[model samples]
Target: MLMRPFWHRRTGRPAHPAAGAPGRPPRGVFPRMGTMTVLPPQIRQQPVERAFHGHVFSDPYEWMRDKDSPEVLAHLAAENEYAESATAHLAELRETIFGEIKDRTQETDLSVPSRRGGWWYFARTVEGGAHQVFCRVPAVSTGDVIADWTPPVVEPGTPMTGEQVLLDANAEAAEHEFYSLGSFDVSEDGELLAWAEDVTGDERFTLRVRDLTTGALLADEIPGTFYGSFLSPDARAVYYTVVDESWRPHQLRRHELGTPLAEDVVVHEETDPGLWLGAGLSADRRWIVVEAMCSEFSEQLIQPVADPSAPLQVVLPRTDRVLYEAEPLLLDGREQILLTHDHDAPNSRISLMDPADLGRPVAEVALRDVVPASDTVRVNGCAVTATHLVVSVRADTTLRVRLLPLAGLGTAAQADPVEPAFAEELYTASVSAAEHDAPVLRLSYTSFTTPPRVYDVFVAGATGDDAALPAEPLLRREATVLGGYDPADYAVERDWATAADGTRIPVSLVRRADLDPAAPAPVLQYAYGSYEHSTDPAFSVSRLSLLDRGVVWAVAHVRGGGELGRTWYEHGKKLHKTNTFTDYVAVTEHLAARPDVDERRILVMGGSAGGLLVGAVLNLAPERYCGALAAVPFVDPLTSILDPSLPLTALEWEEWGNPIEDAHVYRYMRDYSPYENVRALPYPPVLAVTSLNDTRVLYVEPAKWVAALREASTSGEPVLLRCEMAGGHGGASGRYSQWKDTAWEYAWVLDRMGLAGA
Candidate 1:
């Protein structure tokens, strides 16, 4: 499928909302009236700044570390009418839009690897904390039903209540708490069982064995878990990973059946476990792979069972920028294909690497090359054998599934490995992949705007496959797991918005289609003009509420982000970092010129490094935006980067430039440091959200920003604060807890925009 332009171009069709807000939109989606004037630059740039010498930013850094610029009050005062008009209608907007996707029954929880008798199973919690397991066992040799297991009923719904059938009263205490359960492995002869369970949610796990003949526990509690869930491959030995204070994997231990606890010790301890780890076992029980993560991407290391201590070898290592999933191939000759990032671009690439070679002798194949101008290439799925390797690569909006030769994982692979005619098509974000009983590849496809369909096809290996599993229909009566929204629901319109120097900048617009084209609809915009992280087009369902409302949404894919790939990212980083701040402003002006979006209704938002994006954008476009939200923002940029002792502080030097060691880098970061640049003025009403546990984006940064914004902003609009007590950089750990926190920020924004209504 060819990719279409983001905007209405070749189609020559008007982009309109198929459905508006739950309630009436403000004054309909049409252009409204408002007069605008280009203002002078906020920061008084001195001519001496051209040297990149002395204090980096023109603003006071050390003396007024906790202060703000008060001139923002005078700046915002110039655009008073747009703010007042938006405030009048925010209440109604909130009441109408908040309820669309907020309901307990409508919520969902996801975790895979379920337990059942044969192939396929459903793992989920029932009413009252009961754990149910549904399995899809083939009935009558052909009729495979994904139905109930315990009750043995063939209904449209999934199966559950496994404890009742798989175990008796002796095994299951009257009110037994089934802490954990699963189908460990089916075995070569397809007999016997080895599953695991942990009474607690922590890493403590027990490997249990049951006779496919009698279905009973083979041994006592699989001892105490050393680090993570104990894994039992075949009934021979159990393998597991252990984590220390920093949650780093350190050891991989093994235990044989009938062996005394004393001697059955750790078969291997990853020497550089701090930088690497492994636990997943191969189907043939000949290999094991562990994943390792660092400041950058993580790599997977594999060890042969015969030489379990073979020097740490990489199966899928982060060589470039992207992280690839090295899925274990369950064929006669077990192997793995590496998912890698493009070395020269922002896209992702897929290659095959043999786990045997300590990753020294490499075999890399580019599944999808980087699209010259676009940042959209990701590998999805692959099935490898001794003779062939079937791969799934996602680019743009489509998934192309191809079959390559098994030798691709080795230097011996044939030159032309891909089968042109056999390649199949699947939609991106819709398909789900899972291994069946044999070498059958299951393809599950669904779309936010489409229903789900599953396909089980026979992928040829060294030994030819004669029968392919029939395509099955996955009837999901309800709307798909996808939302009727996409990142494209928001538009990117680059235009010239002049700065104090008369330099025009670019801005991206992301708003609901049915908005008043000229009414200055409440807008929530985001940007991150630092680090080479490319903020390309990506889907996120959590942001739909803002887009659903008449409020407009935008992301300033400024210079810092690698949206344009490596070169774009490199240009904005290092000494040229200020371009990030300026690029963010250019985006604001482009969107502000759109009639439906009121300049006064504009709101700036960003987090972490992006927090800096919002902070700078708010100050630069102070007269345009009504409010600002800097989440765990990097306010004290220069100071934070200079302190190597802090966690992530040292790692960010490569991103912000090693200011501590290099004076030139120091001046570059100092120039746009959000905390240092807070001028004395009435700044926009900002809610600075930070987290104490966020080591990446320090809590002090946002805390200082909030304090400064309060002093600088002349507007009585609330400059508030919300600091997550226990959560990490992400803010929330649990699914429900995440939504709760997000709702608070969203509710506040809607109310502030005068959209919160009855």
Candidate 2:
């Protein structure tokens, strides 16, 4: 899991929510509307002045940073109670929404099995299970290897022969309130299994080994490890990373199977605090790649898996503003490195380098251009198999896959591209899984109105210009909608909204097909415009509750997202980051102007970096939305970016400029930092959700933000904060808890729109 460094710090004895009168509000009346069941929390102000770049600023709620303080805990508890009382009238609605979600989801379902190392691996969930059971079955020898792409049909509640349960997450989480599996890997020989788990909401995980044959745990345990860990090719050792004081993964260490924690050897130590380190095995399973990277640039080192003690070979040196990834491929019976780099190409291009020239400097290496950079296309990712090179690209704000032959490479003419066919224009399709040695490609497809579908495409080894092979449908799970549900009853469409600078921002809309165009419908708009992360249209069973009730759902494909291309992301990040907020506001205004949408009943929602988007938009255009929902929001960017002691702050300097070192960046951030820019104006109702153990975006950010909003906002509309005591950046560890959280949020939105009964 790649945690996004969005940007937060805290002070003061937090104020408790004021006690309510003796009587409660009417059955159907919302407390915040007029009949207040409880007074809003009054956070005490203990201003702390700080000088940065010769400018002075005050943070009144800085004392909230003391998580150990009893006062802080009491304040958080008080806020939770207040939020619950404020929305108590929506309890019935929340239950209804949760029921809808539970009814529509296929509770007892099995994922399509993917073969690896002579085993078909998959995860299955029981009807009432909170977690999935990771399992595998020995693969049988088949004459046609490509045909094995069709997964075995394991009926619900039935066990397959020779089935092996790798790790039952439900059992592991039975004793802990919050449980997360950081990483899990089986040894090449399939005798040993390595897994890391985080019992607390904190990101730190404990690594442990298990004997598959005996189903016994090893005494060797490594604590405070990061998310990813790799099993050595020979299964004698495991490579893992540990976080520095600021919670950045700065060291890669190798732990032998039977060795003590003190005896673990440091494989690589990253000196640059701004770059994070991660390790993984190559697709060929012959080499281990240790990569050091920031948002802008990356450097890779490769060591042969066969010789774990060998010195790492540098694939590329760090270059300013240049990013690239290396993939190992065997071309012409020799090892070659496929490089996807942005060297003189904004959209990036794929090149090949000789592995034999390991001692040569990157600049002196003979690089062969394989996939030329295109002005209209942006290459998202690529994978190399024995015979084909599969590339994932984005064009016209839509995802597409292209397969090219890699048999002859430099000497042979280029082959025709093979693209997977999709039924809808606004759907998403990508290579979900693939075996490096197999010709079968496991592709996944989903749209707003369709559940996820898996397909297997077999390449016939065609290298020349010819018609591409058709994909074979493997499996499609019909989501169990208890009351009766049909995708044909819904409609999904794409539209455009012109930004302030005349840039056309793409927007996807989903609603009931029978929705009346003349009637005003309350809309829920979502956007996540950061880190080049594309927000594709995907099916959500819970969303049916809103769509079925005439509520319109929309996604603003604003700049800063990778939907359109790399250029689109470039235009919305760094100095031009405000474009993301403006683009989202533009989309909101456009949607509000439509005859089918009620301008005063629109809601905006986002999380993480998207939380920053929603916060900034709320400040930029306060009157446009009826309500705003921000989850784990990064509202205090200037303060967080200035503090190098905070987790992920140093690594995030590339995304958000280093305000500590540059006065210009400091002033630029001050202009748009949501917390700093909050005004005493009439604002709409707002709800902020955060987690105490969130390492990426500190919970203090939202805590401070809500306090500031309550003090500054002129509008009497409610501003509430809900803090999850045992959750991390992603709230609620179990499926049931997550559904309940979603229901709570949806109920809030419905209540704010005055459609609680709907």
Candidate 3:
């Protein structure tokens, strides 16, 4: 859903403003306010006139886009200094919140182990360690598959009989200021490990291989690679993708061990600038699935893992804008490709097709429907094991997992699917890991009040219970909360907000159980109304700080997100994007009217595309909030989408419409773009956070928006920008540093809500 590939600017239909129309008078030129007061940074206006689609617009502060310039850097530093001075009184509050976050967290912990081949892989986080330690222990197996699949019980910080440390991330990241582990994949035989690291947070990684048995790294060092790199089954080569000049992963390459990097074969290269390329190994490890995808459509290519040099076979040529994921399956002594696709179904469905008919035209090939499309149920994904078909579906606005026996799959006698039961009405359950021969399915479950829990669902060799899944889920572990945290302390409920079009939007809220509804309390409203990414109700250790301080947190499931269904997403994108902003406004009004929420104390927050939502809604109804926080905001959508050279711009055309090629889209985008629509409104105090190295949404966006707000806002509230000098789309990298960032934001929001001393 994010964008870029190199393309020249295109102009379609042309529209222009009146000849005599003049831009806003030069503003934000005020001298230091009263001298004694700490003044915000005063950025010099360097107007750049841009002409596109017969429209000429003047962009002051465009010079901030030159990130390498000394003036821009100095201005950014000054902004940081001003922000620190303005909130200097909150220093104690920030430290207190940080302490609460650290105290409530289990400093030394271990993840639930999952069986892969003969080893049980897991990760450990030691006290005071900023990164995880990847380690594996020998997996013992019995004659029965179900019994053999059980994960061994290992205590935290304890050394096992035969435990091998794969790669200690703390040691690897010790030399870098910012560290991110991109790919950490282990070979099938457990002899080799392929991992990648990004030190600067730009997302381009360097891949390295390690010989686990010898406890030494191999000589293979490949740089400038993207994420999702994997090792071949035989360990002779590694498959990875590389990004182009525009930061789109466009090439899928195979690098053989001990060979020169130049000799690496190009397995597949995506010529379409909008499509991204990535590869993954199938569950059976029989085929390498290379997918070239965009938001609207995708094409999958399959290559036999037995032969690394084999030519790829197309599962289905990119046609009719169909989006599908095909997985190899074995049923009834025959191999078939199971596809969860949106060919004719909006919510999607599961179908079966013969492997031989993969390249045939849609009209020529026959596909048998296994799970028919339903308006109520959206089949999002599927995974196959040696015995069962696992499907993930969203219904009732909650994600659930289902299981179907593979005995008669793709036939008339196929068994009915059974869904496992969960206690909570609003929670997320998903398949975390699935092994080909394993008898158990690893699942991850969480809710607003409940901490994350890992479970193993046993389904193999069951005949007595055909109506329901045979065995009860075995709980492997639940995340540890150090400070006697209890789910009963909080309450969660879903309320409906009616939009202007009479659409009902769902609002999920969590507040302390003792908070009285008769007394209005400050509320923090959050949403990410783009990319179909749902902001589900999940537990957060740091959020407890706000809840304990009488702050209520709520999530608005707006139309642009996939919380409801595909139709909900379709109604809030491209030309219909304004629905996203209006929905947030509706939610704000609804919350303000509630007896439990204070009208003058609500603050808004979102990141990335959600940040755009925050900006737009603030402009629409600034009086509804006390302050706003936008992180790496895509506030300048019109300018970014017009220039295809920017990272991920071309790829974004599918989601936001091709504004460069369409005049209507250009005007529509320009009308509501936060930076373009800044007027003399009673805007609230705003905090914009960004990273200097983020390629997805450049820090320049918030920089420009901050300048425009200062110039146009009628309210004399402070506008602040906090830029991370060495971070990426995500601010700081280490766990400790991330905790501090969270504390800083919480402190700022609390100060705005008059709860800084709470």
Candidate 4:
């Protein structure tokens, strides 16, 4: 006997809402401005109960998960139509915001050229073109390495000498409704190119090879390959990964250029459902490095490229709780392994080890520490060039880069590293491109109030860390802004909010300079507190529209993020996950109490895991916000995590506890899960944006959440859901479509803040 859900028995609504008339929706569903009252779509509640670990809960909208069913598709369409009719008044504001964004952006531009072998690689975007054009010019190098490595100056509208167009993505995107480039890699010889494309936005790509000389694709075509696939150094083979039925990338394979698809070899297979596998050629092009990792731990293996069919050697065996990444480096006529690991240091440290000592127990091998661990500094990553090693680190709440010479890299006489100076108090700077043998390191730098800039740091003449190369960084290019823009018009600053546990959460604020803190203004608060992923401050051209309209923007650096270091992330996951939600609420309360902010006009926003944060916080303090935006939210987490067959569900067990095996975890998740905890409160208006093909955080999660909110809310505010019919995790594919998406969201935010007329 099947048991009916509690909601079904309590409400007694019909399973299907009959049309008021033939070929017409219910009268209130698509009401006009002055003609009829606007009503949200009334979703049907089917009888479904999930019983696990002695807990039974009603799932009214579980049928929405069947994405291929006609009923589900029709419901999604109705939801979209309702959202459009409700916001029909904002059509003018959306268009105006989109125009402002397009006007400030230089539609036609060229990126800074980067040197590879004998060519300078760069991308060009023509006006009105939705996709980029990959092209390159012949390289001209002099005997002096520093002078030879400097990037050549090229104007945006002018053509460079000996330039060749490799690929025009516009022509390829014209064939599909949605298009995304999965992988783009050129062989070391610079003659063969390996690329991939995804048309349906499901993220399953098909690989293809192209000859640069003749501009013709070969007969070699492999489907269902993952991103980051690359060609071998000799240009005779390609290496890629394939996802399993659960969408976990677990198989690493190699395909010879002229072989049949069935003959492709599986280099390594990761049977563990919790781990994701990836393979790439080392920077020096001497070895193929394969790695399998999860949120808490990882293991690495390596194979010499000299023997394409050689067996993979274990560089580091799997340890229960230790995480590490090992890269091969050729130094002083010998090969050494550079490892960044969290063995004893919570914030990772760098060390060097010999290749031959691998495959032995990690405790039995000796390691030379090049960059020692520090409680104050978090080493993010390291990159090596022919002359120096560039280490990216997080200190004082911002990302910066340090340079260490390789002359005495692993020895006792190694000199102290050099840290470059930047003018801004908060900025992101890191190595953008570094050819293994190139003399200059290319850096991409930006901040909240600064445009993107490229620089070339000369390091060819330096002998050791203490040696001086060049004091001034050579500026290559700064992204162009079509309209007259001045950084002085805006002000950026940092503030602190006290959490329940006395921890100070960092909050970044940006707005127009003329706005006075004493005068209250509408505010939009954003955050993402999960997966140890940091939401660093960045410059946004579209955001100028919000700031220029006298609205303040804020970013809450809450727990469960890598912003403050490993401990910050540790305190916000698993059992401590509530800290993420509380930290965000604390920040919101702090903003409401500020003299510069209007307490009644504050709005909150987040996407993906951040959307989870938004959902939890709304349930905690719904009155603190006037509106909210959750993009591709993970609302029904316990249900997804309990079922291991779902996409990437097993991989998420480490981040969120295994609710199926642990009783405490199951109850804790149920207490916080947005769909399960939508109590009868005066919930604010919510706009959930999702994609029909988003595999990471499925559209079903948001669909269920919206239905629950509409059912339980005490306030009359509308809860709308906008699902993209043909898009992936990211909404639509092209730049113009993305601009329109941004405009739509921003216009809604302004309307809620009573600034739509501004």
lDDT per residue as tens, model 4, 421-494? 88999888878887778777788888888889999887744434324456668888888766777888889989
The TM-score of predicted model 3 comes to: 0.94
Instruction: List ranges where model 4 is wrong by over 4 Å.
Output: 1-36, 462-469
Can you tell me which runs of candidate 3 are displaced by over 4 Å?
Answer: 1-36, 144-147, 462-470
- Candidate 2 per-residue C-alpha lDDT over 610-659 given as tens digits, one digit per residue, 9 for 90 to 100: 89988898899887888899999999988898898998889988888888
Q: Tens-digit lDDT track for model 1 on 651-757? A: 46556667756886766666677767777665666777755455456565665566567657766455656656454566643334455556656766765555544
Which tens-of-lDDT digit does each residue in 482-549 have in candidate 3?
77787887899999999999999999999888776666777899988887677776789999888888
List pairs with backbone clashes in candidate 3. Answer: 3-648, 4-648
**What local lDDT does model 1 show for residue 644?**
49
- Give candidate 1 regions above 4 Å deviation: 1-99, 104-119, 125-285, 290-301, 306-520, 527-544, 559-580, 637-645, 648-654, 692-698, 714-716, 732-736
Q: How does candidate 1 fare on TM-score?
A: 0.62
Per the 3 Å backbone cut-off, how many clashing residue pairs does candidate 3 have? Answer: 2
TM-score of each: 0.62, 0.94, 0.94, 0.94
